[model samples]
Target: MLARLTIFVLILMLLAIGWKAWAYRKSALSALRKVEVISERFTRTDFFEEDNRRWIDSGERPDVVFMGASITSRWNPEGKLGDLAVAQRGVGGQWPSHYLLRFRSDVVDLHPRAVVFKACAITFRPGVNDKGTRRAILDLTAEAEEAGIKPVLATCVPVREDGNTVYGSDGKKLPDGINDRMLPFNDWLRTLAAERGYPVIDFYRAMADDRGFLPADLAVDDIHPNDRGYEVMTATAKPILETLLGAGRG
Candidate 1:
């Protein structure tokens, strides 16, 4: 009789665990599916590829390419980087995984000497866990090396719910400890770059205020950098880029 009772308890425990897993997966998928993206067909095929094809096919091969999500897509490459032949491919509402999907076609094909890659806050949103984000970045790093392109990884810009509703459609605040959770991932990135001898751009430190929120002057929304913010990023990046471009491919 005791054996039968033990077996029943084990069955109940397994069912409860299964239910929780299913619920977690459902919520993650829901959050991902609702991201309002600029490219209407982001998941259909290589749709966003067209956004940068012309520049890549231009007679000039760019010295560097800034590949990322919104922060990247919105940069004025020439204004920010310099007058050189630099390319950018940023799509708002995209996670690093999405960038990875097109890394070969959009980034590798351009044959830039190096790529300035930025991590997205959206990766810290619901459903997308840290392991998933880290894996995507690692994959990009490996692919860039295989293509003979330098990979310059960057941390995400500041994040806060103080200014705008970048977090949710209804303006719901992020979970109380989201940034705290993000620290581990950023730390991992820094360590990875150091171990691999890659350059890790510390954008978070450049933009975050004392309390870790983006100052009003720097961000148009809670998630995106404004003109002044972009200026700061440009200033922080140019020196490093100049060094890389100067070195070239020996």
Candidate 2:
């Protein structure tokens, strides 16, 4: 009788585990589908190979190309990065994984001499799955190297949110660990860029206010930066962008 009971319990446990896994998979798929729907409206399909095709076909290779989420798209590259030939392809609410998948088409195909990676602050928050930002960066860099295009990484900007959102509803906030995780991630990126001989721009430190939080004015929303914030980013990035443009290729 005890053996039968033990067998029944084991089966029940397995069933429970299977159900939970199925539910999680369903939720992840739902989120990914939403991302695709949004990407269609925002991303450039021929961004890499066929981007600025007219210009490239005319034998005009762009000096630089910037890719990321909203930060890259919304910012006026002309005003921000200078009057160089640049193609901006930023989709809001994107993670590194999405960027990796699109890199070949969006960035690599463009035949740009250099690629600028502007990481959005939202990516540092929770709800993003897989191995997190580090894995995303590593994959992106690897892919870029294989294509013979150098990647310039930037740190994730600050957010007003104290931490990540708690899962489910109790209206209670869980230990999101966003800020805590972000600092180390930025540090790691800086070190990684140095080790790989890639240039890293440190915007996280530049964007901080006296209180060590992203100023409310710089961002109309807690996550997205406003024009003022973009202005700051552009001003800060001008020197490096110009230097890179002038340096030319190896």
Candidate 3:
């Protein structure tokens, strides 16, 4: 009876250990799957592959190419910006690094006369400095110049006061305080553009309210522009783009 009891206890211990191992493996797999999803979303280098191929096949070269994040993607510069041929290559939910990664393919390969670089407000969220972002912009500008393409720097639009909480592609909440860095980053962008002799489109000045937030009427959310907001942006960008295009022809 004693031996049988001891064997029963040993079997129970083995069963418990097996269950724990299985649970651990399941948890690990779940975490890994989440990471994979994020990685795929952020590293979408081929996001514009099909569109780019179509453009290339059409043999139509644009006079200006707008390259940035979601805001740029939603901006329609076609008939709004005079008669200049414009191509939109904005990818939503991407960082400056991603822009740099696809710069040659998206901007340079299209061979536009000028390229506008407007990273979104999310690129300079709270706790982030401007150093790396500056470097990436410099690299992009330099590459464009080397390829005989002019580079234009556009200020990022401000976020709405109430639209503070942004979400990541993984359905997680992003950090707050995006508005804290918006103005300062735009200032830096202006200084950088001046130093590099690049033209800047002051979208923030056109879109921000007196308190420096995007007004409710102009914002699609905290970080994007509504139709009216984009109209303001288009009005602000028209003169700059026209000047650039005119000078490029000269």
Q: Give residue 178's lDDT in candidate 1 (0 to 100).
A: 50
Q: Quote each prediction's TM-score.
A: 0.74, 0.72, 0.77
TM-score of candidate 2 on Cα atoms, chains taken together: 0.72
lDDT of 2: 0.72
How displaced is residue 207 in candidate 3, in Å? 1.1
Error of 2 at 30 (Å): 18
Better of 1 and 2 by lDDT: 1
Q: Compared with the true structure, what per-residue lDDT tens digits does model 2 show for residues 75-172?
A: 76564455667778777777676787678767776677778887776665556653566788888888878877778888877776643343435565
Judge candidate 2 at residue 195 and give its lDDT. Answer: 94
Ranking by TM-score: 3, 1, 2
What is the per-residue lDDT of model 1 for residues 1-250, given as tens digits with 9 covering 90 to 100?
9999999999999999999999999998887777635333774226446645775667456778888877887887575565556777777777788878678777788788888888767767766767778888899989999999999888778676454223454677665445665667778888999999998778888888898767888988777888988888888877777776763432
Show the lowest summed lDDT stretch of 10 residues, model 2: 161-170
List candidate 2 stretches off by more than 4 Å: 1-58, 161-171, 247-250
Native-referenced Cα lDDT, model 1: 0.76
Q: Relative to the true structure, how large is the alpha-carbon lDDT of every model?
A: 0.76, 0.72, 0.83
Better model by TM-score: candidate 2 vs candidate 3: 3
